[model samples]
Target: MENSKEQVIQLNLNLIVARGPPVPTIPVPVVAAPPTITVPAFRSEKFSVPEQFDGTRSKLLEFTTQLRMKLEVNHDRFRNDAAKVIYSVSHLEESALDQVVPLVNANLAAPFSSITAFVANLEALFGDPDPRGTALHQLVTLKQGKVDFATYYSQFLRIVANLDYNEKAKIDALTEGLSEDLKDAMTYRTDRPDTVEAYATMLMTIDN
Candidate 1:
């Protein structure tokens, strides 16, 4: 019996020795870092200012005075004609004004080279508290270059269209409230002769 017990103990020791200590788990190696991404910088050229209009301030004042005189003399006819033209080329001008003015006014530093830029500036000026500001803004913005002269005429026709006896009265009152220089500046007609002639031709064709 003692020999049997001794044999059993030796069998247990042999089993433990054969099993051996637990093997340590090998850690997984990390891969190389991901590639870095870089973005290119954007560059833009500086804008150049164009030659200023000769006697622009004085001319603008004179124009405004002339416009006021015309408005006063042909008040009824102008209002009626303006209302009629609203739906024609004038509508396009107003639509453009609504788009371009706000953008230009917000960025005064931007160049006013293209019609698009001029329109934007006009839109911004329209929002001014002063009526003269609105008028001058419209005039200056439209006078950017010859490319937009046609557009300016169209817009002018639209403005005329919007004017009625009541609107004229309001404008008159607003003008009265402004400084004389501003009132005069608002009068200048920057519209192209060809455009005006075309507008006249178109007007003649329209039924009363």
Candidate 2:
């Protein structure tokens, strides 16, 4: 019995020795978040032309002439073909003015009501309501200068001067939006016939 008790004590000691100390757990490596991408605000620096040659007058003339032509040619068809007229006219008008005039005019005419609606739409879309919204509000108060044919001829000159003031910034925005190869291909000068022809063709192709 003494021999058996000694053997049991030995077995218990062996069992305790078999169990070792707990191993320390390694911590999980933390993953860093990706950096956010920000698009720079459009600045018009890259396509600078001399103050005298930003082509605002030419653009305005081309726009007005094309609009006048389309109006004359399509006036009869317009009553029956509202979609086609609207498409052609809107493209020309938008290209010329950058903003839709009829809609702008409508909004301006009903300033109190339309501005509230415009503001609500902007907020819903999460659009910035600073410069663009403010500029639009200013449109309501814009008055057409007195019209004379001679004055009209000089009107483009004044627009040219204003364009010159903003040329670098305007061109920068335009060039930034263009691909590098295509950026060189686009010209702002009024001297190029090919550019003029291409624009005219684009306008004419809508109807054809």
Candidate 3:
């Protein structure tokens, strides 16, 4: 029995010796790759108003719209931030900057609160208010003549610029200004456009 127990212990020792020593674990040094940053492709494409704008309120608004659209498209990273927008405006040329800076500076406390108020303030300075109503009445009565359609429409646009008419009123005023034959033809058409600009474009197209 003692011999059998000794044989069992020797067998266990042989098994452990046959299996090599446990592998020594070595800590691996892992290096993290640096993060990649994507820069805007149009980073160098600076934006500014094309020319020194006239003091016309509509023109000023139109210029601002164009500049805003460009910024939104090209500089999307900072487009929604008003501080970035104003910072971009600051870089405009002196002549172009003059057209907008004075107005912006005047309302420094809350510069962009209301577009309507901003435009109205500028309009008061540049746009003549036709309060007496004589000019608008005369303009509405004027009709197409020996003059081409472009000339007639130009006069129509000019007159409407001075008055504060809603879209419907503007369309009605334009329709009234048309010559008798043109007015009849437009009235008969089922597809006549509702907007003044569309109506004018149709007139110009037909006249041409």
Candidate 4:
């Protein structure tokens, strides 16, 4: 039963702009930490690519030496013996390529326990254990046959250089490969030369 006017009193509701309390502040220090250098985890540069091996007996040493150097530098990639052997087999060609391709195809690592064993296998297959003896045998059995003097001489020098023959022995070995005509010409017209160089000169002169 209160008066209707009192019940209908107007609310002031004036436009009010309110600022919120400032957020909790963190103290800023004057000096900042110096920039840190980021050290690289590994060397980005890699070694030179190895020479492809074609299973030549004379070149086995070179091929193996270069491959070892390459593998050592890329040790991160070749963490295990299998990895090293597989990487080595990647640099093969011709008979060398054929010899191990099957193992790789079968997803096999080196048949032996270590990469060194794998290399030893390669050595047995492709390397000359008796280079000096082989060279001597080649010189002893060589014959000029139908080939020209230049060709025969080059072959002779290449094989002979591997041996330690003295001049007289060189002359004696050189006598083995002379063509029949060269032998006849030297025997009849030429005086035997004491030095192997003189003998070689005389034979070349007759051949030309």
Better of 1 and 2 by lDDT: 1
Worst 10 residues of 1 by lDDT: 83-92
TM-score of model 3 vs. true structure = 0.44
Question: What local lDDT does model 3 show for residue 104?
Answer: 72
Reference-based lDDT, residue 41, model 4: 70
**Tens digits of per-residue lDDT for model 3, 141-188:** 777867777888787776677677877887777777677767767766
Candidate 2 residue spans exceeding 4 A from truth: 1-55, 80-89, 92-98, 101-208
Task: Please write out the lDDT profile of model 4 over residues 1-208, one tens digit for every residue.
Answer: 3565554442222212134456789999889889999996776368888889999987887788788888787787666888788777778899988987776777665545666876887898998889889997888789999887778888888788889888888888888788999988878865889887788888888888
Candidate 4 wrong stretches, greater than 4 Å: 1-37, 109-112, 135-208
Cα lDDT, all candidates: 0.41, 0.40, 0.64, 0.80
Put the candidates in lDDT order, highest first: 4, 3, 1, 2
Lowest lDDT sum, 10 consecutive residues, model 2, at 46-55
* lDDT of model number 1: 0.41
C-alpha positional error of residue 138 in candidate 2 after TM-score superposition, expressed in Å: 33
What are the candidates' C-alpha RMSDs? 20.5, 21.5, 7.4, 13.7
Better of 2 and 3 by TM-score: 3
| TM-score against truth, every candidate | 0.20, 0.19, 0.44, 0.45
User: Compared with the true structure, what per-residue lDDT tens digits does model 1 show for residues 1-208?
Assistant: 9999999999999999889998889999999998988875543332232222222332333333343444445445433433322211122334443554454466444424443333334334433345455554454343313323345345554333333424444333333433344435445734312344543443233311
